[model samples]
Target chain A: MALNVNVLREEFPILHQEVNNKPLIYLDSAASSQKPRAVMQAMDHYYETANANVHRGAHTLGDRATQSYEAVRDTVATFINAKSRQEIIWTKGTTEAMNLLASGLSQSWQAGDEVIVSRMEHHANIVPWQMAAERTGAIVKVLEINDKGELRMEQLDELISERTKVIAIGHVSNVLGTINPVKEIIAKAKAKGIVTIIDGAQAVPHFKVDVQDLDCDFYAFSSHKLFGPTGLGVLYGKQARLEALPPYQGGGEMIERVSFEGTTFNKLPYKFEAGTPAIAEVVGLGAAIKYLESQDRSAIEAHEQALLKRAEELAADIPGLRVIGEASNKVPVLSFVMDGLHPSDLGTLLDQQGIGIRTGHHCAMPLMEAFKVPGTARASFAFYNTLEEVEALFAGLAKIQRMFT
Target chain B: MSLPNLETFKNNPYGTETAIDDVLENFEFLDDWEERYSYIIDLGKSLPEFPESEKIEANYVHGCQSQVWLIHMQDPADGKIYLMIDSDAIIVKGLAAVVLCILNAKTASEITNTDVEAIFEQMDLIRHISPTRGNGLRSMIELVKSIASQQ
Candidate 1:
């Protein structure tokens, strides 16, 4: 259970490689994590053994395929501690999930009803709400953030009015890596009888997420970020909420009975899952969760924190290396901009030394606007990341400085 | 984020169409991608000074990995539109140089008729630039073409 990068690194086949004649040092986990052998095999084995259209197949492989597919539903349910497997609806990923939620919520929201979003939200959380508001005649309000990039929790009362219909926010900021006060925020919103939607795309990758503990009405996350295959997402909704909301998409699997007159919709989760779902990806996600449960998450958190602290200490060495998002609580996301070097230039220079870090606005342009810069070069750590990788980043950065200046 | 003085680009060589041909020749001479990357970055060092005052939202391209500002002038004598691009990043600036060397000083119709992607292919830049940068490059070209077409 102890965090061992050397041992864990072997589990990831992609990690043991060279880039630009140097060992690959990947710190872009915030974007996507490298998959372990288990996840890849689970998906591959599913295709090789049980490959058929699920829920409709009646033959040998069909029944086996359906069983394997439904088994992952139970796996995800336990992974998030959902009340029942029926609450977990499959989508393409977080973006599709957001769009689905927005479209469904639009049918319920009335004109002039207020939808609250935060300043640090990724476009996934913000744009969908805006479109929902635009469609429903509801108004979108923003919760502000302070200097440290932490949401101003003090202003929550002022932001939430009687007309506030929903409070949609990110559980963890993708850019700042701030672990938001989501539990507290959910409680306050619940007290006011406001619907709470938490974007857990960033949170699910780093720590354990219990929907019951958070008491959120809806939670969304992507499997790819959790070291699983892409084109798969999980959206956990309260059973009652799922029943009340209209279906996001209408297709073969989502219908109970299709008629030219009127069609009856399917039950809770299937109603949201429109067409043929990502069966192999669902299997991969189950494997990713199983792999995660095998580790001591607390130790993973500690290892990541150690890496971040070491990077911060190294920041003092670079004369103008400005660290952004100094949130008191965070995962392992380190966003910063050098005094003279642009983020893309820094990212390119680092890439040459076989280090991969994300640069630019990172799909959060408003956050960049608020920070008064175009973008920041970010090196986000994961459990597999090591102290040596941190040192490599600094060495590459030092070389970049030498070349540029 | 103020940029350092780019006064060295006063007599910039990459401001004309012939510069594209020059780049094509130089790219042909390079043996590997690393040398080409270095060559492109060196092009960035020669960016002309874009005025601080012109760095406003009106001139800004919305969807770029780095901050990209574009300014242009239409010559009455030749009916050609001369463009200048600026970015905070070195490689992006180099990309801007690549763009300008092909499309700058051409009339709007001439710019539209120009095979920009073909030129990019000739340099084999499609394989070199990152996907995000490739998107940014496409966005810049689109912005340029859309604006030129409006005139």
Candidate 2:
């Protein structure tokens, strides 16, 4: 089933505008995806009519807002195929969720306990654990990646010792686009009683993800990367884990009862969500998920893969252009570094031609260090990205090659 | 592999020499951003060639969108600083050239007194540049000022 890329492109109004007198070709979706009309309209509708502080007011607007907001919990639960709606917690983004989990978990970990992470994790995943280790005296063990950008599964046994407390990693490398073998890694962690966390920020946008199927203790992703608004992400914890972990924050709506002497916390999900949430963005996320559900996901994936292949084929012809990662199973993220040109130069020149691509360490400095480059120019695709857009990017790269080299 | 040859660059063959007034007047004449952008890239074509040895880690400046390096020396005779800066990215190299042209060969007291940010703002380049690049630009200026203050 072929998706009509033209009709899909029409759904995102921002994509149609001319940027430097040329049509906009956005390849920076990995940083944050552009919202479609459905998502924007849903947020607009929420603000226009159902604006109210949720779960507290008894008025008509309040009731509407509360119901709409709570319903999205169910949407998120189903979207990730979690066990229950109560397991889904609203967070600022993947960064916040990881920080919350690390802070909460480190309190229980003893000195010298090990927390395992990979070299390919985004700074969001790495920093939190480092902070936690700094505070708790717990040790952090890093799993190295091979030259091919795949995790060295052979070294996992040595890294995971009896004192291992947690194993946190990305489901897909933001820089490499390699789909990690999380299920296998999670199973190994589970056998040793180490808690597992999957940073699904890059993976959720491109393919099907089932938290239950993966059996990860906690799975997190940002909504903006999935064609929704910013300032919100979903953290899916197994029900028991949520119940066991202490509240990451203290404020209104997260408490069951408060007295001068003592305050008891609220139930699951609410315990982690403190104060008035990003209500409109949550509504927008629900609409984004609904919009995704309407599309044939497999067809979208196939379309994206085609774009990746086209980009890679073009890269092969460019004399000094080196495509960074070549994983067997991957998303539509193509990163490269030309011999004479810097990634930043490539990114700047591409932007002049009205193409948007991300060029830098991608907040994955360790991965950049591991790859032995300052940064890479990455072109990440969403389902709606057209082959013509890929062609436009190639043309921009060619122009950059002509002028700089 | 390197920027323009300084000998040829100083000759002003293209009249693309980035004098403060020349930069201002040219930017003023170019009404549209597309034209202004190509001109900025053109500005990069005049930066002096950078040596491979000076590209070491100690001279490297962090927080830039590009890999930037700055190396400087005080001229014993004039009591002025001679600054050499480079970047892997062409636009940033151009930006470095712009900064170097304004501040090079100036005494520490003179550098501490001049408001370079105002000059860039006067050019209306602030709004066009990315935030990270803005930080990079400021960082370069900060490095120069700190070096001046130490003197």
lDDT of 2 by residue, B41-128 (tens): 6777766666777788888887546767887777676777767777777777776666776777678998898777777788666532
Tell me the interface RMSD of every candidate, in Å: 2.2, 2.5
Please tell me which predicted candidate would have the highest TM-score against the true structure: 2
Per-residue lDDT tens digits of candidate 2, residues A42-112? 98998999999999877999999998899999999999898899999999999999999999989898889
Q: What is the C-alpha lDDT profile of model 1 across B1-151, one tens digit per residue?
A: 5433233222345656346888888889998646776787888877777778878888887545566788777766667777778887788888788988888777899888888888888777653343556336677788779878988
| Maximum-DockQ candidate | 1
Could you tell me how far off, in angstroms, the CA of residue B14 lies in candidate 1 after the best superposition? 2.5
Model 1's alpha-carbon lDDT is: 0.86
Runs of candidate 1 exceeding 4 Å displacement: B1-11, B15-42, B51-63, B69-83, B98-135, B138-151
lDDT of each: 0.86, 0.86
Model 1, position A48, has a per-residue lDDT of 98
